[model samples]
Target: MRNLKYYFAIFSIFIMISCGENAEKKVEEKSKEETQIETEAKVSEKNVILFFGNSLTAGMGLEASEAFPVLIQNRLDSLNYNYEVVNAGLSGETTASGKNRINWVLNQDVDVFVLELGANDGLRGIPIAETRKNLQDIISTVKEKNPNTKIVLAGMQIPPNMGEEYTTDFRNIFPELAEENNVELIPFLLEGVAGDPELNQQDGIHPTAEGYEIVADNVWSVLEDVVEKE
Candidate 1:
C-alpha cells in the first residue's frame, strides 16, 4: 500500500510537470504569433502613392529606374517618408483605357493618386468631350473607392497638329477638372523637357533619362505640397 501511494504521488507530479511544460510552450508560441502579427501590421501601415498614366509615366525607352515615378520614390525614401509608389503607367494607355483599369489598379488603398492620362487622347485627336467624360469617370471612381484619397492631375499640352481649337480645349481640360474635383494640379508635366531636343529621346515625346530628372522635379514641386500636408 505504501509503495502504491508513493508511485501514485510520483505519477501525479509527472503529469503536473508535463502540463506545466505544455502550458509554457503554448504561451511562448502565442507570444511569437502576436509579435509576427504586429510586425505585419506595421508593414501594411505604410501609405501608398499611385501614379496612373501612359508611356511618359511608364518611362518608355528608359529603364524603370529612370521613370519619374521611381525617381519620386527615391526622393520619398531619402526624406524617410513611409509611402510606397505604384507605377501603374502603361505604354500607349489613353484616358479611356485608364478609366477602364482604374478600379483594378485601385485594389489596394491609395493615399495619393497622380493622374497623368489624356495626353494620348489629345495626340490621337479623341473628342475633347469623350476625354473629359472618361477622366471625370475615372476621378469619380477613385473618389467612390476612397473619398479621402488625394488626387493630383498632371496637365499636358500637345502641338497644334490637332488644330489650335482642339489644342486649346485639351489644355483647358486639366485645370477645369481640378477645379471641379478640388484636386491638386501640376500645370504642365513636361515643362522644361518638352520640345527640347537634348531632353527628349529619339521619339521626341518621351524624355531622356537626363530629362526625367526635370520631370521628377516638376512633379515633386506640387507633390511636395500635397504630401507634406498629409
Candidate 2:
C-alpha cells in the first residue's frame, strides 16, 4: 500500500509540472503575437500632415474619404510620399472657432499644417480685422507648438453680396497673412471649382467630390514644394 501511494504522488507531481510548462508556453506565444502586432502597427504609422479648416476641408455632405485631404493622401501615396493626412475640418467653423480649437488639433506631431479656416467668417460678413486677428492667433499657436512645422494657408473668397469692399478685403486676407507669416499660400482654394454649378453642391458654397479634386490639386501645387524641401 505504501509503495502504491508513493507512485501516485510522483505521477501527480509530473502532471502539475507538465501543466505549468504548457501554460508558460502559451503565455510566451501570446506575448510574441502581441509584440508582432505592435511592431506592425508602428511600421504602418507615418508622419502627419494636418489639414485644419471649415466645411471645404471636412468634405461635408459626402463620404469622409471623398474629402480633399484624403484625396491629397491618395495623391501622396501614388507619388510614394510617406505622409499621413489628418483632416480636422469642421462645417460652418469660423476663424474664432479655429483659434479656440487649434491647440487641441495640434496635440500630435504635425509635419505639415494646412490652414483653411475664415471662409465661414467671410460668409457671415464678419469683420475683416477680427478674422485676420483670429487667423493670426491660430498661426501663432501653431508655430509655438512646432516651430519647424511647415504651414500652408488656403485663401478663400465670398460673393459680392456684401459689396466689393468686403469681398475684396476677404480675398486679400490670405495673401497678406501668407506674406506676413512667410508661409506658403494657396491662392484660392476653390479656384476652378467655385462659381461652377457643375462642381458645387446645391448650397453653391460647398464643393462636390469632383470640385474637391480641383481643390486638392490647388493645395498640392504648394504642398508638394514644401514636402520636397522636407
Candidate 3:
C-alpha cells in the first residue's frame, strides 16, 4: 500500500509537468501571432503621393528608382516620415494627354497629386487656350472625385524665341489654373536648374540627377501643406 501511494504521487507530478509544458507552448504561439500583426500594421501606415507629369517627372535620364517622386520618398524617409510616392509620368505627354488620362490616374488611392503637364504643349507651341481648358477640366475632375486631395501644379516656361507675348500667355496658364483651382503652385518645375547647361542633360531639356535634387527641394517647401507625412 505504501509503494502504490508513492507511485501515484509520481505519476500526478509527471502529468502536471506535461500540462504546464503544453500551456507554455500555447502562450508562445499566441505571442508570435501578435508580433506578426504589429509588423504588418507598421508597414502600412503611410500616405500615398502621385506624380503626374511628362518625361521630366519620369526621370528620363535617370533610373526608375531615382525619379523625383522616389527622391521625395527618400527625403521623407530621412525625415522619419512614412509616405509612398508614385511616379505616373509619361514621356512626350502634353496637357491634352494628361486631361485624357486624368480620370484613370485618380483611380488610385492617392492623397496628393503633383500636376506637371503642359510642358510638352508649350514646347510644341500648342494653343494656350486649349492647354488652359484641358488642365481646368482635369482639376475639376479630381476635385469632384476626391475633394480633399491636394494638388501641386508644376509651372513650365516657353522659349523666348516664340516671342515675349506668346511666352507670357504660356507662363500665365499655370498660375491661372492653380489660383482658380485653389491649389499650390511651383513657380517653375526646374527652378535654379532649368537654363543651366551643366544642370541639364545632353538634350538640354531634361535635368540631370543634381537638377532633380533642386526640383525636389523647390517642391519640398510647399509639400507640407499638401501632404502630412506621418
Candidate 1 C-alpha lDDT tens digits along 1-230: 21343454455555655666657776566556555655655554668899999999999999999999999999998998878899999999999999888989998889999999999999899999999999999999999999999999999999899989999999999999999999999999999999999999998999999999999999999999888522
* Model 1 local distance difference test score: 0.90
For lDDT, candidate 2 versus 3, the one ahead is: 2
Better of 1 and 3 by TM-score: 1
lDDT of 2 by residue, 1-230 (tens): 21343454455545555666657776566556555655655546577899999889999999998999999999988888778899999988999988988888988889899999988898889999999999999999999999999999999888898899999999999999999999999999999999999999998988998998998899999899988522
At residue 113, give the lDDT of candidate 2.
Answer: 95
Tell me the tens digit of each residue's lDDT in model 3 across 71-189.
Answer: 88898888877778889999999888889898888887778888889888888888889999988888888889998888888888867867798899999999888888889999888
What TM-score does candidate 1 reach? 0.85
* lDDT pick, better of 1 and 3: 1
Error of 3 at 7 (Å): 52
- Model 3 off-target regions past 4 Å? 1-28
Highest-scoring model, lDDT: 1
What TM-score number comes out for model 3? 0.84
Question: By TM-score, highest first, what's the ranking?
Answer: 1, 3, 2
Count backbone clashes in candidate 3. Answer: 0
